[model samples]
Target chain A: MGWFSWGNKNQDISEPSRQNRQKCWETRDSYFDCLDRANIIKPGDEGNSCAKEKQLYEDNCAKSWITYFNQRRVLADAQKDRLAQAQAQADSARK
Target chain B: MREVSHFVTLMFSQRALASLARRTYVGGQQTARHGRRNFSQTLKRQSQFGKDRNTIGTLTPASAAVFVATGVGLYFYFRYEKQKLLEEREKERSSRQYGRPQIGGPFSLTRSTGETFTEKDLLGKWSLVYFGFTNCPDICPAELDKVGTILNKLEPALGKTFLPVFISVDPARDTPERVGRYLADFHPAFVGLVGTYEAIKGACKAYRVYFSTPPNADPQGDYLVDHSIFVYLMDPEGQFVEAFGQNTEADQIAARITEEVARYGK
Candidate 1:
């Protein structure tokens, strides 16, 4: 059921936002890696010691990525619609 | 013997005895034998009566209480076992080929009226949910139409126990107002939902829906969104009951749902 991911790609994002998002994702990844090394399947909540890096990533980069991802999706949708209309117009002219 | 003779003479006169003698006369030995037989019979009858009393007297109150309690307990225990077996058989009879999948969970989206719609809103009624964008070229429109027809047929049989819901997969273009306009062309009772990309994605994931990037789209936004097309039926408890594929006809869906609702209440 995981056919597509919401966090797949945001190529059109600004350089700084992209860097920030990457850094946050990396930080979260590193925390998960640490958990893996420690043989922990799931990290503890805010009160637990293992959540510090993950919390940092959530606070710094996750919000920006969410916004960028949504913007990209909307723009892509608009582009698709424009293409369909152009094709429709061409077909009508030929007819 | 002399005393007995005197009593008998007093009771019956000589003339009467003489007349009785003409009918039949009991000799002394015969009379004694008859008396002994009567005495032995009376003693045996008394002993049998006494034995019956002794048996009844042995049944104390504690033992009587135990006897009554055991009788009642066994009766209810057997009844419970019979009911349990019946329920198991019913479950086996109703077992489905599409085993229960963990589909559906909490989701928050905006209704057509600019109100927040959550999973709680789906409670207390049966719901038929389909995921697609309003701008879908053919499949979405066709499926929605079929759903509308099914709803119309279902209404006569099920009344208002069923709800039809359309959740947008392409939330970017399907605003609440746009969704509302799209649904207006279908069933009047249909509810349209639109939300942020994350919210819509979460809802789709929960329902095991598949959708990917639009195919063959130009720079302009006119392409069709590709997504899985199925109408999901939910029970009153917001659990998944079944899903109907694209080829299923409206009447087929209606009949199946009518049977389902009759067998298991909304």
Candidate 2:
């Protein structure tokens, strides 16, 4: 009964604390850095390269956060490409 | 010299009367030759009586100038009045648009303290309502922090008359207790609300908030719910006054709310 109560308490306190969130962000950054070193624009593409870092990130952060971060990483890269293309077009137009 | 000026004025008056008679006679469609003979008789009579053709010539030009000036003045006067009327109408239309925004309506949800809260609860106080989930990693926290800053800035002067509310879009994962605990990290004055999926959907619809948390999604599953991030300002009467986007500065929002509160008092 005590074990069940403890589990209930854990379920009730679902949101991460401030320190836990910081830890999650740290792990996420480390994992993303590994992915960047591997030249992988997409997160899931680096299968075995950053497995340890990915495990740490998954354990620290919530599932929803992980999904959001992965999607945002890809989106940010795409946005960079678009901005570069726009800059090149602007330069050519100026000439 | 005065006698001579008076005589010239009398002569001009006589000439005006003669022209009036000629116009009336022409209106009757009399013979063209008869009209010409009458004009010649008047001219002969004028020449015999005064022999001052120079006075008549000069007076004609002066009267013509006065007539043209009066016509132009009337034209501009009417145009100015028309322009003023159009501007007044535009002002009234804009006031009507801003005075009564159709943003909020009937909604029911559970407050963080396990009490029933409805749109009626929003009445009698200015409320800042935001729609977000506790699981939002970065944006929601940043926005809530901004709201906290605004509340802290306004609380001293506006105290109790102002309320900040957070409504959870992710009902499946965010229970009232969880939402309450999450909001404790921000301003204590905040009223966190959560409800069943249908109730949350109705509330979102009432506020015109677009959230993408699917019904029947696994509560334990890891997925992000995309939603609109706008903080709505409602007047004491529960009518929406404005919606502040994510980029709006806390100072700007505070200034706006202070202005609105003053205006409402009036």
Candidate 3:
């Protein structure tokens, strides 16, 4: 069963090219920006507000990439909040 | 007479009585007093032959101590030398037997050109292998770029001796043509490999790579694959040499590979 599958003929899926990946990132950024304007930290929480941008994001990017980017967006926002809090604490300490 | 008896006692204590008895047996015609005179004469002859023999006859406490110390020192010196030789042999044997971990093994995968690539293809050239997917947005691209930098650094000194390879862990999406197109952005020398899921799994197992790609997952499903990010360096004989982590700098990897190539076949 394993030896017969060694041929490349069985592979039906093709990976994204460099240009496709760039488009995916652009669409992802646009979608995330829309989510930010709607005050939505989670990707699915934007409801029908960012529908056009979300459709482009889903179309341009791979499924796995969309998932990763969505998770990274929330994490990056949390990290930004923590950094701002730390800065405020440091300023109070200096005074 | 008392002095003569003391001399006789000293001769017996030093095991010289055997020689004295031989002399007495040889001169059986002589009287007992004549035999005693012969023993004193024999002692004088021995003293005249060697200064060391005369010193032994005197046998002072300080000289005896020096003799015993010399014997003990020589014994310990030879013992230490023997021990050192044994340890050196053991070190050599161990290095030949188990110095490196068993990492690389037989694997068959497809190259970007749709050619069959096996473990035998890794022979006769140094190879740096990375496992990643083309869909990886950040980490894989960043690592491939770093590999490009390393290759640029290694080109002049190493020439065509080193090969940079990228094998896709996400075989469901990474077809040969797609892998080729993806690698075209990094470096012209990069050889991208893709295979069936089972084939990719076998290659990963040979290199001890871990990936969290479900076997029967839908190709269109949106799920990120969690995988170990490392670059494996294989020697010319297809043996595992070293592994560079994600945090290792390109210059460091290049320097290490240059050093390893220089040390090869010596």
Candidate 4:
């Protein structure tokens, strides 16, 4: 399809190149995987087709997952501080 | 300017859509006198493509297979070796980054098994310690998972010498039994320790941890404990080896732990 579209120079202004544009569509599979994992794109998820479910997930799930990863870092830092203090105390007692 | 650049990169060279016009221009069939020869040549070329292109005009399936296989083989092999290299790299990374002992002072705790575990236990072997509660929802679960990943990454090398301990902050609820059950979610070798409030407080204070119950009490009378997330790595000498950041990926943590153990002779 990209090969055919390559010669169609008169295509719409908003249209992306067709060469390796198929590669960008690779995210489509993972998008569906994400939706399936989140349980938002099931056999009965309202009227959402694969495209809509994928779009919704790309909009929402991607951000939330990032937030989840970020929060876990803060949690680690707090724990590190507490543990580091214990280490300091032990060092002092050793002296 | 950015839009133009984006348009150029995305619309033009990206898809190679512009390149297709050059290929078909080799001469359309309408311009040919030997139209049958042109069609025959195209069909032969197409069939030759099916059989193998690299073989005919730098198009051989054997060579292509060798080429593609080289790519795919390199891909899978790199994935294979990459996994091993990553493991080796991880092993190297852990050894390199496993800096400084995390346990410095007192780390005394009364275990559910009726044994008192102190820094002395950490002195003779490598230890992976965690300060979390069974009740914690997100933070605790994530940290424990990290500890499990780190241990799994280390246990292979450190063997039985690697000790992964989970000390409960909410001792009242995290009884020995609950701790046992909670360990099920992580590495089996995970040691679950529960003590009285004082013993736990002493341990947490020794570790410099702070935890407060949620301001809004559990409406159903169930309490929520908000605690920090960190996996404490203690050296064989029971000194603080290093503490990994919460956001640190599991592989990195494992790499660090492995590095420290190798340094400490784990």
lDDT of each: 0.67, 0.82, 0.78, 0.58
Q: List DockQ for all candidates.
A: 0.01, 0.28, 0.29, 0.01
- lDDT by residue (A1-95, candidate 4, tens digit) is 33212234543212122212233334444554555565543323434445664454334322323234335545766788899999999999999
Off by over 4 Å in 3: A1-14, A26-41, A44-59, A76-95, B1-97, B219-223
Model 4 CA lDDT for position B20 = 31
The C-alpha stretches of model 1 lying farther than 4 A from their native spots are: A1-95, B1-88, B91-98, B213-220
Per-residue accuracy of model 2 over B1-266 as CA lDDT, tens digit each: 34445555765665576565444543564433433566657655545644344353324566678756755665676678888999999999789767875788998999999999999999998999999988788888889999999999998998878788999999888888889988999889899999999999999999999999999866665567789899999999998999999999999999999999997897
TM-scores for all predictions:
0.48, 0.68, 0.60, 0.44
Q: Which stretches of candidate 2 lie over 4 Å from their true place?
A: A1-13, A34-40, A44-52, B1-100
Clashes of each: 12, 0, 0, 28
In the range A28-62, model 3's lDDT, one tens digit per residue, is: 88998898799999999978999999988887876
Docking class of 3: acceptable
- Across all candidates, the chain A TM-score values are 0.38, 0.87, 0.82, 0.34
> In candidate 2, which residue pairs get closer than 3 Å at backbone N, Cα or C atoms, i.e. clash?
none
Better of 1 and 2 by TM-score: 2
Q: Judge candidate 4 at residue B48 and give its lDDT.
A: 46
Best by DockQ: 3
- Give the C-alpha miss distance for residue B248 in model 2, angstroms: 1.5
lDDT of 3: 0.78
TM-score of 2: 0.68
What value does the TM-score of chain B take for model 4? 0.56
